[model samples]
Target chain A: MLDTAFEALKTFDWGSDLAALAPIEEAATASHGKPEARQDLENRLIAALKGTLTRDAQDYICRKLANVGTAAAVPTLAGLLLNKGNSHMSRFALEQIPAAEADQALRDALPKVSGDLKVGVISSIGARRDSAAVPALSSLLSDSDPAVARAAILALGAIGSVESAAALQTALRAAGDRRATMIDAVLKCAESLLASNQVATASSIYKAFTDESQPRIVRLAATRGLLACASQPAVRSI
Target chain B: MSVIKKPTRRDFMKTTGAAFGVPYAITSAALGNSERPAASDRIVMGGIGIGNMGRGDQGAFLGRKDVQYVALSDVREEVRDKSKANVDRHYNNGDCKVYNDFRELLARTDIDAVHVATPDHWHAIMVIEACRNGKDVYCQKPETLTLREGPLMIAAARRYGRVVSGGSQRVLEDYRKYVAPAWAGEFGKIKSINVNVGPLPQLCNLPGETKSEAIDWDLWLGPAPWAPYNPKRCSGSFSINGASWRSFSDYSGGGMTDWGAHHFGGATFICDVRDQQPFEVNYFDDSNGKYLAYRYQNGLTIYHNKPKTDQLLIEGTPGEKLAPKPVPGYKGEGGIYGDFIECVKTREKPFRDIESAVNTAALAHLGNIAYQLKRSLKWDSVKQEFVGDAEANRMTDRARREPWQL
Candidate 1:
């Protein structure tokens, strides 16, 4: 039944009868208990992905791989990361793999892809909170494309490490047209920082924006962030 | 319920006093009036995904004198045009701005609040983005499409200090009969309640049809996997069959979440367990068929599709009476919508706050996972994951297509 599904998958496209793929779906669930069965299914799906198949076929396999794929499936998925038609779905599979290999694949692809594709990779990295990729993302802050630059800023914000917060603070000083975007990202970083109990670090980020030189709204957000920091148990302890 | 302070004519005058110097120039719409409050004092509102429910929500807010509905958004041209026409008709002007993208509507700093009635998939992204943009949200039921979204949405709302309310009017209104009795302690020491909902969402492999010019197909499928534009695939119908996006696992949790948002929402409210999630889900597959018993830490159990049990049927200690606890009701005039708007003004939690709504939605999701895995599972509510079950943990959230991350 699984072989029959794979055979039909070669021509599978949007609107195809989904009944032909029932075996693959069934295997995804039935293999949950049997690790060997799960790995075998993953291997078969990865092979089909590497074969000459329709985009729909690849999409289905990637989704299944996301559920059962291990580090073994990372390399093949990463190979498609630069393919415009396949990058998003590849990232889709990579994002949920819960393996360090998936994170490394995304970071490696960051310098290889540009524009929207790069932005997509950056987003996946941020979603994974790949602290190792923070340096690579920080370098993209000044990328020529505003979308790429903004994606980097947002990705850094999502990472929300003390280093990411510092990068955002540095970017805020000369963010030009991206200043508002940077401030929002910086505040997001501060909020996450506060959440992780780095109240003093969050307070420092907040204090930077509270100056009279900043916009009233930015000052208001900064003041609120500072107030939140002050109200923290760590700060209250002192 | 606490006494709600209605904006008196004098109060309106005091609030809109900034235009006192320009009284001669102030029109009826801009000036303080007995029937309609001044425009300056009203909650500036917008609607996203103005479909069937969106239209109803729009009308609810539009009918309110305290709300000034300024904008509308929908992926389909006809829906957007018709909704804008409705808004224009209500205000007697063609000034209601329309957009194809909801982000455009959320970007307007002047817009104080937004009502999101998009499909189940779009709810979390729109709500969180709206909150991030400093706009309060009144998002439709099943506000979360995944377990992970619940916490993120709640956090975004809290961090921004935005008044975010879940759209589940039926939880309190439709289930009032059961709710009142349960809260009144008519059934002493409530044991368990059965909520019958589902036919979990299935994969969508609908044959693609010719793309319609009337709708932005790409925008409509935003963040979801690429699929051919089939009418039934994106239909706004309530049915959870292949006829609508509600039937697809990518977009919804079928009836489990579609109507589960109301049924489970009602069941939890009746059991006074709206704020809690089951600590363990025991799946049963016997001669009778499959069902689930969700055990909560509070000693309350919720049975999902248990055999021969009626929906929202409370199994409790019989004949023994206890002191009645006050049933929480909507704060202001017009049901849940009024509750949301009133909370927006007073900064109070709404009758169906996001946390409680997420909890209800979480029940449907947890049950769906149990059914999908066909195994009993222990859930660590604080961690929001299955205990020691990596396979079950993988089912907690799905990978969204790129450029859209929570």
Candidate 2:
């Protein structure tokens, strides 16, 4: 039953019998209680998910993986996410991994991949709340892909680390046309870092943000960060 | 399909305020005795926050005849009126009250239960207050603003003996149903569950806009620390000026608190790990410019990595992975609301109960504390305090303004 489902899923063009596959797939999962049956179902599902990596396949796989909600497909999903050429499918697969493993897998896969895949990996890692990817993510601030670089900047903000503060400051300084959004990301990151008492790091970052030569928004963010981190007595004395 | 014209903000505010002001208490007697209040009486319900999630919660209860629409509440008067009209139109209860103040609606003794669809910050107070007032609560995900509030809410429910359930509903299904049997054990012991709530994607911050007259700025700012009235905070738009409440610490705990309640809460439920203090809490706060890792005592770690898209990932021993499955006919994709209703009748534990809800809240709060402290701090779940960290401990409970004592 499970093999038949996988075969159907693999050969199944989503435009046609996609609706018909639900019951067979359901039966396979419903019978997942038995050890042998469950493994067979998972194996088939994983194969089907990997087999269907085309645009339609990717969408179908994402929907199927989302419906299946099993860990057995993590490796395949992670593999897809790490595949640099298939950014779309990679992202779709990355979105399907349990949030817990998504970041770790992406972090581990970051150095191994580049370009669109790198951006997808970085964005997915940050989205999964994998703060550990901060170092890799920080480095990606210089990523050639503007989307990836922006994602790195935003991911840094989401991760909220002091380590990434300087990088954000640099990114904020180098930001030419994309000033407002980058500045906002920088300020949000700086504010978060300052609140976390990454003061020394935040202060330096603030200094860069406050530099008169920088954009107006960056300066404002730096000023806010400084004031936010300032002691009450310091504020009163000033 | 009737193409409903969107109501203007001013019109919504006036209609909602007028609807709430009327002494429109709904009596259970109006519904047939079949819907009578009993130990197992079907809970006639009304939905507050009937926008994206509000409609979903309403749909769960609306399908059952045992539950009747009593009222609907939303700050956006348009949403409130539409939701009220929707229930009345659907259930044919033309007289149901459309309320702005959820408190007023909850005040009625006839309302046995209320489904809270407000933002994350409003959840703790609303749930606690609702339970305290004898109304069973079905609150949306990320049950509380902080970990500290979770226990307080659990206590309120326990003390008041109200059926309070969190919105992480995936726990209702037997774990074995979706995945293979061997895959479960192969996944190794539950190692760590990471939840990615948002990639609301990067958007530029806009200058604060003038508060529209249609909005009850004061009411919308309830409980959150006062800030300049901005449309972003109340309008629920992605723009900072429009939805700035999400970015501010005073209003929300960012994505973790907002979506963490759903994604992370799901893992806590599946693993059955409750009230266990993370040995240590640390955050990378890559938003500042770097990605870092937060480690916990149980050998579990949480990462706040940003993803390209919104999804959840769970990693466990033997490298098992679990992601959220789309459960159709299930409330909110995870069936959390439906489970709560079922539990309300059967007196069973919902997917994410008070204890687990508090634990998930604690975890998110710990992340916030770690972000604030800028250093990893030890925690004692039993003590409910940061071990030897006074400043961090201070954050455990927030200062509620007078007249709203926790």
The candidate scoring highest on TM-score is: 1
Q: Model 1, which residues run further than 4 Å from truth?
A: A206-237, B1-25
**Model 2: share of real contacts kept:** 0.00
What's each prediction's TM-score? 0.92, 0.51
Per-prediction backbone clash count = 1, 54
- Model 1 Cα lDDT, one tens digit per residue, B1-406: 8999876423544444545552435576778589877776788899999998899999999999899999999999999989999999988989899999888999886688999998888888898888768788999987888898898788778766778999878888898888888888899988999989888999888877886659998788877877788898999888887788899988898999989999998998898888898899999999988999999888889999999999888888998877899998889888899999999888799988999999989998998888988889999998788998877787787656556655
Residues B54-107 of candidate 2 have per-residue lDDT tens digits of 677887777665566678887777777777777777756586788778778877
Instruction: Show model 2 residue runs off by greater than 4 Å.
Output: A1-238, B1-41, B169-183, B192-208, B237-244, B283-298, B302-334
lDDT of 1 at A220: 73
**Under the 3 Å rule for N, CA and C atoms, how many clashes does model 2 have?**
54
Would candidate 1 be rated incorrect, acceptable, medium or high by CAPRI criteria? acceptable
